[model samples]
Target: MWQGLLAFVALAAMAGCGEQNGPEAQMAQGQAPNVKIAQPLAQDVTEWDEYTGRIEAVSSVDVRARVSGYLEKVNFKAGEKVKKGDLLFLIDPKPFKAQLNYAEAELERARAKHELAKNDLERAKRLFRAKAISEEEHDARSKGLREAVAAVQSAEANVYTARLNLDYTKVRAPIDGRIGRELITEGNLVNGGGADATRLTFIVSTDPVYVYVDADERSVLKYRRLGQHIGAGQTPVRLAVADEDDFPHQGTLDYISPREDTATGTVTLRGVFPNTDDLLSPGFFARMRVRGSTPYPAILLPDRAIATDQAQRFVWVVNQDNQVEYRPVTLGAHIGQSRVIKEGVKPEEWVVIEGLQKLRPGIKVNPERLSLAAPY
Candidate 1:
């Protein structure tokens, strides 16, 4: 009787197992995988080129002393905006005054000599008429008068030189700009060799700033071949700065190099920026974009959707069976916060953007269609 009961229990267990996976499971076997697979969607993707750049002053002037003298007073504060011909520094005038006095005295002495020579010439002519003096003596007097007149002219030139030297004591700004730090203090003598002398201060024009960006030979050729010539003929260059969220200033392409740099394999293109508020300074790094090129329609994927494999970049594609498959992709230039997808998955296909780590091929899954919770 016990053996019969055991056989019956075994039969019931087998029947229960059969019913668990009934006809419903067999019907869903092919369609279950395709029921809901999450994959990244790729739409239209555009192309763009980017370049890095830095801000600089177009006219950077270093204020130097023209004449050697003690720096008596600093008329303007450091970092102050100054106009053209503004007084920047003052030198001690005592020594220049003495030199001018000497020149004046010499001039006065020459004038006295000239007057004496004039009287002597007149007397010599009178004596020659009366035959009271020899011809040689009259000629000697005439020669003396000529020498005296030449001396007067020499003295006049010396006076003018002395006046110019005195004027040099007062130093003025060569260009209208914002001045930098003071190199020499009051009572310190600065040499005035001009080019060879150390700069007393720096003066850079802040109204308009210049920016230079590197464009490689390939890029230049590419643009030229496309007939874009985006760097030529007053083409507008857009600027992107690190400090600003949006493009704050608009610049135009002012210069494009003819040749490429052998060391860097790039050519320098220059742009002029209007820094009216003095916000842009030299050495600030920024990005440059060439305008006038037609933007292509492109598929943009958010930064989160892409993943990297060893030596290959791919995205997880959920198949009809709810299995994740790795799809290799090629990415193009950046578009705002997203990247332009050049190759890989198609649009509207569910890409495993989330829950990718827990997936394998042919794994049955309970697919929950994820919705975009926040707008990017």
Candidate 2:
């Protein structure tokens, strides 16, 4: 009887030791892991799409000499602001002036001859009426008068042409903008007023600048369906330069190419921006963003709450029982710190924003409820 009682006590002691070493012992002693969670935020949001592009001038002009002559003077310094009709270059005007003088002398001579012929024709008419001159002689005087008048008209046209040529010697700015370096310097002979005219310099309008970008076919279709017409100048856009962290420049969509580029599968778009302070320039590499979609209510969660599982994206959703489960989600856009959840998550449901790494699907968590406004 004593041996049997001792054996039973020993067996109970070993069993107790085995129970302490088992997984149940850890379960009784260990605490649930702490995690922070918040409900998804639902708000009205507009999606923005980004693009890379280049800056272009709204108006650009290649200054070319309009008349051939030796360049005598450059009126404005290179890289300076100039207004319309401002003199930019002066060709040698001596030849044009000489031609003008000759034309004026010829005009005077023709006028004198015309007056003499008119007087002669009048006298002949009177003589013919008085039967003092023959019909043939009177006809000859009339013809001479007409010839003199034709000569006078031709001389007048020559004078006008000469004056126009003289004016062309003084090259003026065609637009108000900044000018580039002089390509043709003083004393250089420049060919002008022809297909192969010499380019003196170039200018670009600086006030209202243009930014050119290309968008894919899908984006174009999306914009069209959303009624966000980029060509109508209603869509708003923002841009930043390479060194800029934020988009400081604002503009409106002004133009869209009529046809898409077949090879590139993109449509060219232009945005107009007011560069009042001359902060923007042409040929600058820029990052542009335009409103991709209209404002609509969306479910949003902090980006930190999102987790990736191989090919899938998910979030740790806390159920009513304080348990976490992997919830697959479809994302839309990331605005600020919140990402748009297109599907798979409801606004009323809480998601684990903190302690995501310690979470597993269907695991119980000690969730300390936190607001989305809390910093990580």
Candidate 3:
């Protein structure tokens, strides 16, 4: 009987202890998971739109002969910098010089004939005054003098033409630019100043180059609206050529097509950039970007904070109740370490940046708010 009473007492004590520990076990287990939260950064930022484009010279020229002749000499080295009025090529100047000399000689002979005719008219005038010559004879001498004067004028014009032909023998650069290879080498016969004129070479302006891009209708409209506040060239732009990691070149939007292409439904845009270093060249593949909008206040969060469920992007927000709630957000371009949240997220809201996996809608969390600055 004593053993049975001891066993019953021990069982009663164990049962009572177990009942007390049950509530404490449940209370202490699975405390709210600790998480880090931060308010979205409010900043004023300007967004940019990117496009792929090709570099083009501000001006390009196809050098051609202006007078038919055998090319006597090439004045410039292939791939050289040339300035306006710089002599580029010399045609067979010997022929042009001879023509000019012949014209000058003809002009001198015309002057001598004009002088003799004037002398004859004077003599005829004296004879007419003394009645030693008929009126018809005096008129004939006067007419001869006029004909000689006309011949002199014609010869003068021919001399001017000859001088121009002589100058054409020396082909000069029409613009300041970089010249390419000599297409018609020395001693080659070249046709000039007509439909069949031979091309001598090519040249293109180097500094302050242009970049052209085709922008869609939507972008065109946006740019037009932006233009209401800012001028066309006032919009900031940047460019990067092939092998460049970043847009080191700065420029501005200079031109926009008056109409869109009916077939492509896109408009052309041109940006002009200063290339003092001559690093940018014509026909180079490049990447360009234009400022999308004026600086505006925006909310930003770390990219890692945002989670995607199917196509929907969301973030876990801790409300005043210290409870996690699912919130969808509209994200914009990445700005350094943070992403712009255009909509569905407020700058003052606490967004869970870490320990996001433990979050569930309506779940309580121990939020340790942090002050995290964007790297950008």
Off by over 4 Å in 2: 1-36, 134-136, 225-231, 366-376
Ranking by lDDT: 3, 2, 1
lDDT of 2 by residue, 1-376 (tens): 9999999999999999888875445334665578999988877888888899999998899999888999999999998999999999999999999999999999999999999999999999999999999999999999999999999999999999999999999999999999999998899999988899999999999989888999998987776655444345688888898899778899877777879999999998788888999888899898888778877888888898999999899999899888788899999897767789999998899999999988767667789897775211
Q: Give the alpha carbon lDDT tens digit for every residue of 3-105 in model 1.
A: 9999999999999778667544543464333233333434443344667889888788887877777889989998889998998888887888898999999
Candidate 3, overall lDDT?
0.90
> lDDT by residue for model 3 over 145-201, one digit each (tens)?
999999999999999999999999999999998999999889899999988999999
Question: Which portions of model 1 miss their true places by more than 4 Å?
Answer: 1-48, 104-157, 194-198, 223-233, 240-242, 289-292, 306-331, 341-376
In candidate 3, list every pair of residues with a backbone clash.
none
- For candidate 3, give the lDDT of residue 83: 99
lDDT on C-alpha atoms for all candidate structures: 0.74, 0.88, 0.90
Q: Give candidate 3 misplaced runs (Cα > 4 Å).
A: 1-38, 123-139, 302-304, 308-311, 318-323, 331-339, 353-359, 362-376
